[model samples]
Target: MATLNFKHLRYFWMVAKTGSIARAAEQLHLTPQSISGQLTEFSATLDVELFRRAGRNLELTEAGRRILSYAEEIFTIGDELLEVLRDQKVKKTLPFRVGIADNVSKLIAYRLVEPALKLGEQVRLVCREGRLASLLAELSIHRLDMIIADRQMPANLNVRGYSHLLGESGLSVFGTSGLAKELSGSFPALLDNAPFLLPGEDVAIRPKLIEWLETSNLRPRIVGEFDDSALMKAFGQAGAGLFVAPTAIVDHVCEQYKVSVIGRIDAVVEHLYAITTERRLTHPAIVAISKAAREDIFGVGKD
Candidate 1:
């Protein structure tokens, strides 16, 4: 029997986590050819076929699944051992890595995560903004400490992650002062035939907002659709159209975007979630974010 190759095992682990050799190679800072060769060598050493193609993705064979389970344990323990060692270093800066899902409001994200910087310790805050599925991939590979998302982990996703509800916020409609002034009649009635800027179809709030509009029987002409909530707010600031934003950070939005709230829609709520690999949050930054979101931002934790 030959001695085990820890490097090969690590490569396999990364590929399994990312579900692509190219992605794993990118993370490892190695060439795809190099990793491909190494993977071949690793499989030959073990004398087993580890992967088979399933559509565009690489599916682990039964043997590969067994190997991956062992690899996960090995690498996870190795990472913890390194973390324990790193913690002993005095005044060492802790890396606080977070991913913000694209659908989440930037204003709310900033407020929820800002408390981590004031933890009175040396902490480096790094944030990556992307789609929820992409952020979940990063979370599964341990590249991100946690994900700040508008939704929870999808049940169909194979990644093992837990979602902690930060809190929910009802929505508010905002428009420029001139636009708000021009609107006639009362509340929902005023919104009919009004110009509107809506979140993109891919966004979690888009469907809910549509349903609310349908239920209320108000159909504002959608002047524009934006994937970036911040960008949508910018258009709203310019009097392009009225837009909806979470009421939790409505004050910040109104101030920053220089818009006036036309009305509040308590029926449509945006549920915020913190998605992480661990069920019980252990990271100080994550803990701080969850606490601040519930108590300060969403006003749920307070008595």
Candidate 2:
């Protein structure tokens, strides 16, 4: 056996993470040739093939996957050591990487994650926003500590993860004061032909919302659709159209967007979940978030 080189291991880890030599090189500020050479040397030292070519892309072999797992632990410890030394603290700040589904409400995402920061542990939170599928792919590779989503992990998804239901709330419709006053007929009746801003079709709530509209026999004109909940509220505040948000933060939405609640859709419930690879939520930050959301935010016990 040959002596292992940390530099070579780091290069290999970067390649595995980005899944492309060019991308890894860009992230490391090195040339692709340099990274390739390091990987070659690292594989030679291990006496096993690390990567297999698949149509211009690199895929890790079985041996490579096993080595990469150990490499992850090694680099993670190295990061913690550096942080402890730099901060001169007995306990290093823990890094918590959470992926937020693009369609999830920004305000709700904030409320879900806020408890993690107050868990009395020094936590460094890194949030990435993207589509649920893309985030799930990253989570499968152990890149994300957890995912905050409006819906639970699909049972058909190939990834091994458990969805912990954070809480659920009814939907509330909101609009500018002028718009609210202009469409004054009744609760469900006022929504007939009303200008509305709806969530994009990609959101989990879209189907439920559509069903609710049909059930109530309301046919509001959808003037705009938004993937981002914050942007939808912004347009609604500008009187573009009425929008719906979870009732969990109804007060915050109304005050922040300067909009008045038109009505609540109790039938269209919005569920929130914390999806993780671990079946048991043991991370300090994860535990805090789960407890706070169930007890304080969602009021699960009071019911």
Whole-model lDDT per candidate: 0.89, 0.91
Query: Which residue pairs collide in model 1, if any?
Result: none
Taking all chains together, each candidate's TM-score versus the true structure is: 0.72, 0.77
Clashes of 2: 0
Give every collision pair in model 2: none
> What is candidate 1's lDDT per residue for 152-205, written digit by digit as tens?
899999999999999999999999999988999988789999999999976888
Cα displacement (Å) at residue 41, model 1: 17
Identify the candidate with maximal lDDT.
2
Per residue, candidate 2 scores C-alpha lDDT tens digits across 65-179 of 8789679868987988987788886586788999999999898889889988887778879898999998998899998999999888988889999999999999999999888
lDDT of 1: 0.89
